[model samples]
Target: MNAALPFRDLSPDAPRVRVTLDGAPLDLPDGANLAAALLAAGVGSFRATPVSGAPRGPFCMMGACFDCLIEVDGVTRQACMMQVGAGLTLSRPMGKVAE
Candidate 1:
């Protein structure tokens, strides 16, 4: 679970961009990191471990960590490394994750 933070409270006029995640629509800051957007939206687990089924969420907001890996337009990408784009589709990467 994500520890809730004051998102809009941080900036009353922060610009927002719309995006779809796991088939759900969300609005987030246009320049905010995608991972942060997910977290702010209370999406805790980005994916589950293929082996132990442990929940994996973003650890580092930088590109150094793969824990935030997500499916972007059918490609695996680190959510923390990208900004929210309007109308972008994101989902949990499924099937045959390397062991």
Candidate 2:
């Protein structure tokens, strides 16, 4: 193994953990919000339209807009308002309906 590879030491400053999103494993930063983390992970959409089945993501990161809504730990929540935690399980909503 190449010793120079990054993330070799998952220390506090270099926090490393895995999270599951829509049944996919994702590695995210230690203290970032789900919205931010998803964005950084190259996720352009976080939700689907109720009527048309289109895609959506964070719009007003301050919790005013309902665009960034998602399900965390089996509960509906705003992705922008929830911080990313280790072993978190997230599922994007297909629409406005609660699951």
Candidate 3:
């Protein structure tokens, strides 16, 4: 675990799989929650608010909050609802507007 990150992985021994975040390669625990893994890996911000451009990260950790929204393989999704999978390409969603 990175000492600088505020989050820690509960399953330190879990097998790691490679994935990309904003085109940067990262080796994260396989099948772990995407938001948690990213946080543990020192990713503090998941996206920016469409209008204000304020930083946003996982808040509720459940599907109810849209704060964890990210682009997975070109599709926008909630990071908290996803699992860490090998070769997944993730990025902040672009041009999104709040309803």
Which numbered prediction scores highest in lDDT against the true structure?
A: 3
Query: What clash pairs does model 2 have?
Result: none
Instruction: Judging by TM-score, tell me the better candidate of 2 and 3.
Output: 3
Per-model TM against the reference: 0.79, 0.77, 0.87
Write candidate 1's Cα lDDT for 1-99 as tens digits: 345634323543678878788898878778878887778777788887776778788897878879999988888899999988888888885444676
RMSD of each: 3.2, 7.3, 3.2
Model 3: worst 10 consecutive residues (lDDT sum): 90-99
Off by more than 4 A, model 1: 1-9, 94-99
lDDT of 3 by residue, 1-99 (tens): 235867888898999999888888989999999999999988888888888778888999999988999889999999999999999998875455866
Model 2 Cα lDDT, one tens digit per residue, 1-99: 123322232333556579998998978778776676677666767779777778878888899998897888888889999888899998887855444
Counting clashing residue pairs in each candidate, in order, gives 0, 0, 0
- Give the C-alpha lDDT of model 1: 0.78
The C-alpha stretches of model 2 lying farther than 4 A from their native spots are 1-13, 95-99
